[model samples]
Target: MDEQGDPMPGATVKVKGNEGNGVLIGTVTGPDGKFSLNVPDRKVMLEVSFVGYVSRLIAASDTVSLKKVVLKEELKNIEEVVVTGYQRIDRKLFTGAAAVIKAEDAMVEGAIDVSRMLQGKAAGVQIQNVSGTFGASPKMRVRGASSINGNQKPLWVVDGLVLEDVVEVSADDLSSGDSETLISSAIAGLNADDIESFQILKDASATALYGARAMNGVVVI
Candidate 1:
């Protein structure tokens, strides 16, 4: 099951050695996120993994017949996984203009908004607060505007959910304001503390996945 208690279809379930190496038996979860495997005589570990979620390894027991497993959404430590448009690649092998801002660097003491956290952090990205009001969001542009007929704002993605249009988050879900930090519409409703990291994708090579919607650029969080 996923963190939402919904069925996590297509989750990989593999049997590994005690040391977390060598696959013994491998299968995938069904529509209900359930699986059954015939255990071997020796002690072994069960490894389960899914996209957009953290992988887990657990001890397998022949005596047990049923096991309930849940996969949590990955919120941090994505240094190895670099999301480049439609696909994910290794950070070392990516050949695009993708700049990564680690979680620790963005979660500063007084950082209350994504604009403040990203200010002066990424290259070719400009952030300026237009209003001084308590809830005024800043104006952000990646490599300046790319289109005159459409929006010039960069597309924002949080935990794989893209926000190209207006966002409708509950007011009660927002964090308390420390003065005015109204920044951008795509990122205005986000909580800084909950963000794991920020990946600014510039250049046409990095923004090609979204087609015309990514003409300005993209920010994967």
Candidate 2:
């Protein structure tokens, strides 16, 4: 359904689960704006996307069946406020390589964590889902790696509090098993429901405010 309660057609429906690692099933809505997908019995995320509207994510359980869904049309020219290091500024006045993802926009279907929400959303930002274990977080690099010996992960700040990157992986862990043991990111502790928005700073112009600490990049939440 559309925001006006009218039936919509041609909307995309995708299902993702651990078995698929990504999209397991993809289909389009019928002429009456109804869709039925046969997904695996395991836990999955259902993504509904339509052009000119905001996409919605719905988590699915074994017994879950979607009865109704609505898509809201996009609003243009709405000013957005973003956090740039120590200050909040209007997005129009900011001049730098940065991207902002609101909570609604970040919540994609099949996303297990916040880092997964950022995959391919930002231009210079790269997100690699290296681990499939429970409670694991993906590896993120901003504007590529800058230092050989230093940490390559982006700095994460939640509600003005800087978070520490605690990823540690031994070389032996990679070669010894079919599935490499990946260290979870400290940001994995955050609750996705509590996050309002996230701003990623990619270039020096946007990250200089944090100095050396943001050499890799900055993810301000």
Candidate 3:
């Protein structure tokens, strides 16, 4: 039975002897939350347990007619941290196309940097290798370039602050792999342990928050 006087079916009733180790003598309660067990002619222990409720231990008399028991419900609340943008908002309240990748989930065994680890981590976001070299900074694009001679990188934001400092690489620089191949991404300076998650916002909602600078999209870390 529960604390509310309601019958709790399927509760386990065990007739454990003096030593309660390796004993499997137990039975589940009936529909009316009642159980009967046959034990030796000696004082033993009765262990009552149920899921989502506290377990109870009672002394079983050497005679018959055992006492009734009641169980109590256990309630719990959980808060999961999954950042999406500048502020935390419920999924039902936010109308944006966003993908969040946890640092622990995106870590690769032999990945040299965070940029390669982010490859294929989000939808409609491309993280391509600028060169075949191991230390070359990868190119990331949320969408196709809007202009031929304009800034083509996605907007970078770290903890609600826009980061304007970035190494600009032209198409020719990428082909020859000489000018910016050794230059690391701005995110490379950040400690991977300090990074919680990467949130990529890819729609009008991104531009609405940062204006034309976010026309390409937003990468919030």
Candidate 4:
């Protein structure tokens, strides 16, 4: 672990079976002090041992999937670090409403479009798929539409690049069946599988990053 009791980066991780004859698997933790290993589909007793910490044993079955595994620090005197806006703060020093959704929960919605899966998932943000057309994209608005002339659509940022004209398909196009009439003139393309997570920036404090462009809001994909 780190000096602050967090997972130590570059820490050596070793996994072995209860039987001494089993092969030894070795790996190093990342900067997040996290490591993942994929073993064969079989019943075995797995052991995780680090340099300075006590070894831990876990029973593994063919059907079991280890999604997240957290290792506890041996020392009890170290303090934990809390991440904040461009800074690391103590958890006891901050007050705010924050929610985190895992991959399992997001997949359970069975939504082909990422925007549709966000419905009823987050407050203040609204998602509407007004068309039943095959591969029809959804309409998303954070907080609410603020402008009449200017675009009400949120800014879509993929990776570190800001996607220009993210909302090319207007509501009128969907309603008037213009999108259906034109085979190759549909909306801008975006693959949902490429997205790791979606974050909606709402309220003035969150929307201030993009200046006036974020008056409507922003979506980080």
Candidate 5:
């Protein structure tokens, strides 16, 4: 029986050698999660894996029976994997705290500006909208402003590449500045549908890789 007390029918079962290299010898657990496969008389390893289920491996002996094997579903957290600097790591293994916001959640508040979508999405991050204009820009800060004279903006990285001097135009730019002037917009050019996930690195350990530029924070898109 599986964790839910239901039979794992059509569960894929594999037989492997001790070195973790082997073939897909056979499968087990039909609609009832029960099946059998013949193995050699030598000490060998057995691995069972199925979609939406956690894989399990066990050592089998000649006298072992293949009855009553249970398979359980894998429960994954949405924030389990975080973008750390230029790399990705399991959030539990990370030494610092970070927040992850999916594209779907970002659109929940009907936020047209990409930065506005991040408002209230993270615990420590703060987002301030420049205005209600159609092309207005939003300012983002992790924790709080850390620099007095230098730029307090966090570094932005998209698809593993560092984006330099990313700028956004405020509503004032549209009302007061030349109508033909095109202000730099960071999130305006990005396709929200194409975004897989975003990570806001606020802790020191998470931003340490970027050196002084990331002292305020880092945003990985």
Candidate 6:
């Protein structure tokens, strides 16, 4: 479970062995945030990991066997060092127009999906809700209005890899008010609380690294 006691589905659980490079067993949490595994040793090390949350290592003991474990949110400060995907630089030495929104700061109550979270969080970044359906993604613009239609979308990046839209649909259909077509999004199925932070690049020097794909600007998560 997360700090808020929310069930974390699909969280990975691993059993660590002694010494180096040893993995005994592994499993994932279910929808109810419960997992079970039989280990070879009575006392084993368990590592729980979920995206954007701090990982925890626990000792498998009789007392804690059936108890619930909580994973805290990862609060990382980017003022010390700046990891801009392509390179690493000191924050003071780096000069670029970038805005960061921490998960805790931008979170809305009862909001598992973040399509509306970025609405007014970052500067120069505009977000419009294309659909009101559950898990639907919002339309986003880094500098300009979403008036050009959905001809293109801002590049989606996680860690250092780029993500492509899974569903291919035209802007005309999306704005047609049809509920089915409006239920499209890249991170719709993702839990907003799992995100650590959002880095918005609003300047040329900051977005030049992505070339044409980032012509609209860059959003790093």
Highest lDDT: give the candidate number. Answer: 2
Candidate 6 lDDT, tens digit per residue, 167-187? Answer: 766666666666655445555
- Which residue window of length 10 is worst by lDDT in model 6? 145-154
Ranking by lDDT: 2, 3, 6, 1, 5, 4
Model 5 lDDT tens row, 23-125: 4466666787776777664477778888777887766663354455566778876456887855667777777778888878777545575667778889988
How far does residue 23 in candidate 2 sit from its true spot (Å)? 62
Clashes in model 5: which pairs? 9-30, 10-29, 29-33, 29-34
Instruction: Give every collision pair in model 1.
Output: 134-180, 136-182, 137-182, 137-183, 138-182, 138-183
Clashes of each: 6, 0, 0, 0, 4, 0
**Which parts of model 1 are misplaced by more than 4 Å?**
1-80, 147-150, 165-184
Tens-place lDDT per residue, model 1, 1-221, is: 87677988899877765335453577888887887776674477778899878988777763352366778898765446677757877788788888888877766675545666788888889887555456555567886865555556677878777875354322222233434233335666778878777888887765457677677778989
| Candidate 3 clashing pairs, residues 3+ apart or interchain | none
Q: Model 1: which ten-residue window has the lowest total lDDT?
A: 169-178
In order, what lDDT does every prediction score?
Answer: 0.70, 0.74, 0.72, 0.54, 0.69, 0.72
What TM-score goes with each of the models? 0.53, 0.56, 0.57, 0.49, 0.57, 0.56
Q: Which stretches of candidate 5 lie over 4 Å from their true place?
A: 1-79, 166-182
Which candidate comes out best when scored by TM-score? 3
Model 2 misplacement above 4 A:
1-78, 167-183
> Which structure is stronger by TM-score: 4 or 5?
5
Backbone clashes in candidate 5 total: 4
Better of 4 and 6 by lDDT: 6
Residue-level lDDT of model 2, residues 35-109, one tens digit each, is 878877546688889977998878766334366787889866646877886777678877777898888888887
